[model samples]
Target: MPAYTPPLADFTFLVKDWLKIDALYQSLGLEEFDAELALEVIEQGGKFATDVVAPLNREGDEQGCKLSNGQVVTPDGFAAAYQSYVDNGWNAMLGDIEYGGQGLPYSMAVPVHEMLNSANLSWRLTTMLTESAVLAVTKHASDELKAQYLEKLVSGQWTGTMNLTEPQAGSDLSLLSTKAEPNDDGSYKITGSKIFITAGDHDWTENIVHMVLARLPDAPAGVKGISLFLVPKFLLNDNGNPGERNALAPSALEKKMGIKASPTCVMNFDGAKGWLVGEPHCGLACMFTMMNDARFQVGLEGLGASEASFQGALTYARERLQSRAPQGVQQPDDKADAIVYQPDIARMLLTQKALTEGNRALAMLYAKYMDIAHNSSDEAHDNAEAILQFLTPICKAFMTDTGLESTSLGIQIFGGHGYIREWGMEQLMRDVRIAMLYEGTNGIQSLDLIGRKLTRDRGDMLGITRNAFAELVAGMASGEAQQHASALLDEWYQTSLQVKAFSAVDAAGGACDYLAYSGYCLLGVLWYSMADCAAQGDNPVLAAGKQKTCDFYIQRLLPRTAAHKAALLESADTLLAVEGSEFDYL
Candidate 1:
């Protein structure tokens, strides 16, 4: 196995050159953040990820987590690593300053998070969940709730988990059967058993806060009756420290194919004392505040896995001796020749590089808008919010799908060795598999993209995307990037019209393909812009690599859009031709 090297140079290129962090700061009227400070954060974050987190990944996977006597014990060294993370103020980076946080923009956290995920994704889950939980609390929680919980969570002395799934509910919250009754002291008694809760119980923190969803006694039926609650593992004392144990315990740990280090627990709440975080009968809206953030973070997770697998594959390709290249022996001094010289090996590596870099660019693009939506003035806010809504599902589904493809290619490049455990490529594939299933499965994301964001809004959100792409194309110098951008804009316009004509059944049938179409088009635009940026810069090698990757995306990957488009335009008659009962004929 190879070491996990942080993509520091690529992060620098994306933040400083591609995304133009300095100008973005100036435009948003943020005087505090400049390119210098951003680079510094990336540098220090890279060091921590490489030094502290990466070393624990393989061991954590091997040791996994053990449930002994009702308490979950994380793998050896996991506790020390987490303590170091908290002591170093890493968890406080993106938290609100009002609650002992540093108040940094989400854009600043993007690269740092990528490094962490690449270094150790299983270990990174707890940290990621805590940050998302903080966002939900900051946005919806009352002052009293914030004062009691925000400081501890932000400082990483406590961790947080989202409790939305029950054995019966899964993604359909309307089926939830949890009960919450009003208490005498202005709290609620929550009695529900939540399953598949990530980081539900961990020993790294002094306490755990659960953002739960349950139904009130007087609430209406279905999802409309759901309400969000804050259920703490230990009740806070008068002095603001953990006092008594709440009526909650992990009944069993879920055995899984990957991310075994991150405990997925079955939490039984026997009248657990809880408090509502948002208005009554509006739990879904409040939980979405956290879910949206989690969705984007899951996209980042995909990007990280893609990078890690690519690096591993690239390392192997450069050293593993195999048959000679078709043309001739590229390395005559070796026993045969490095596989990196072979055309097929080169192609796989190039595809991985293109997808990984393009996905990083796309994620930063989303993060930029996230900062704008949160901090900008009225007009900017509306536009940014629209873009965020439009991109959320695409980012989650497309990135992970393509990311899975990239990692699988990594395995293919390694041949039989890739399937072996010590090579580590297989583990990367296993871990990344969960991203597509969780945080609203990729299929669910596609439905949200087409049904809610596109057709429901009558293409208003897509029009926002079109205008941005047009403006991007118009400003570029006449070249391949210019041509690619114009072509994508034209295809997107035609495709949107076809999408508008989709019937309900047809839209559902083609949602995944339509999402892929949109994601490919979006990446085309991003790659062109990135290529243009590199061409005008001083680094010739980097510039050449960027241009070649852009070309590869155009020739090899962009063509995938046509097939997706065909699927999107096709009628759902054939899809419905087969009855649901036939699916289980085997």
Candidate 2:
């Protein structure tokens, strides 16, 4: 297994310099936080991730999780690691203080999460879902339900799962068949099966809270009838302790690629007692409160995976001897110079580094905007919310897509050795593949971006985003970086107009490409911002290195946006013209 190291320098740079989160906290009346306290938290969080959770990653992958007699048993050390995680109060880092949480800003928690994800994604999933559940219950659940469940969930003595997908209703919630019958006592009995539930059934905690979506009788048809429910694995007793077992079980587990340690279960709920959360016929809106968080965290998963892959590949390239340098025999003492001297290897490594670092900055800003949108009372809150709404799909889709690419590059760097299990390169790829598929697929995210976000209110959100990017570009010093930023902003503005026009005719055909185009341009802006920050910093080596990476990104990667733009302009007829009968080459 590859040794995992927390990228403390990169994280600190982002938090302390790039986002200036201390000022943000102060502006938001978060007087208790400062740079020192935030760094100390990050350091301790890094230690926990590095010392405890990381070692279990390969072991968990090898052992996987088991479903025995309807109970899901995670791999060895998982339960203990989880215990350590909760004992240190890491789970409550971003929760509300009223719910026994730390009430820290989301920006402060994001880096800790990134480190956790990089160390062990499977292990991270348990808490990730729990946090999302916390968000949902806090936002939409009844105050009584909150009184009963929120404290335990925020404390991490229990875990949570979002039960959305069904066997028949893949992405179409309108076709959901889950039934919720009202009881005389004002509770409901939920009866249905939900598939692809992460952390659905686990032994790490005494209880598992499931945020379920079900339909009520005598309600309108389609998604409008769906309602959110808080269903627990163990029904609460009169004293509020876990009492009788609920009528739910993990009927089976999905055995497939990636994150094997995390149980993706086929859950069966046979008249399980549950409480209604939020208003009737408004479950989809309530559930979205949680899904948005999940989507962003999933994007962080991509960033985390990419960071891990880059570290592994960089370490291997520096130590693994292969061909000599093209210019000269720099390492004549050995059989040949390390692979790091090779141009192609350097290119691959640089690509990974560029994407990882650029996305890291983007993720930080995303979290910063989230904090402002949620916590701030300033006038910027509305703009932040609009920008966040426009950027969420891009963040989730682009980051995960790049994660798959970066991990694949890790395997490619290892060559045949990468294919072997012992090298641990393949596991990263497998684990990251699910990110692209879950929390709504990248395709669906793109549709949301183009069809909904871009076109809604006649491009108001896009205007907010473009104006934000323009301000960032205005801060850049005159040179190649400034030039690149200017070009990217212009391209983004022009492309949005083009996509808006195209959507009038056919949106689906261009949605995916438009998203990719927008993502690349957005990352270009972030890279420019990083380069600008580095240029003004005191650290010579770090600044120089960042400048080089920024240049490479601008010169090499930013041009890909042009290709996506061209593709986005293509008519939908090209895709729709193909008949079902014509695809039968097999």
Candidate 2: the clashing residue pairs are: none
Query: Least lDDT summed over 10 consecutive residues: which range in candidate 2?
Result: 498-507
Q: Model 2, range 422-476, lDDT digits (tens) per residue?
A: 9899999999999999999999999999888877558889898898788778877
Q: lDDT per residue, candidate 1, 1-586, as tens digits?
A: 4588988778888888877889999888889999889888989999999999988988888889988888999998888999999999999998888889997777888999988988888999999999989989999999999999999899999999999999999889899999999999999999989999999998898899999999999989999999999999999999989999999999999999999899999999999999999999999999999999899999988999999999999999999999898989888887799999999999999999999999999898888888898788787898889989889998888888988988899999999999998888888888899999899999999999889988778687888877766776776775766886888878887787779778889999999999899988888888888888888888898999999999999899889999999888998899989886787886
lDDT of each: 0.90, 0.90
Query: CA lDDT of 12 in candidate 2?
Result: 79
How many clashing residue pairs appear in each of the predictions shown? Answer: 0, 0
What TM-score does structure 2 among the candidates reach?
Answer: 0.98
Q: Lowest summed lDDT over 10 consecutive residues: which window, candidate 1?
A: 472-481
Residue 167 error for model 1, in Å?
0.7
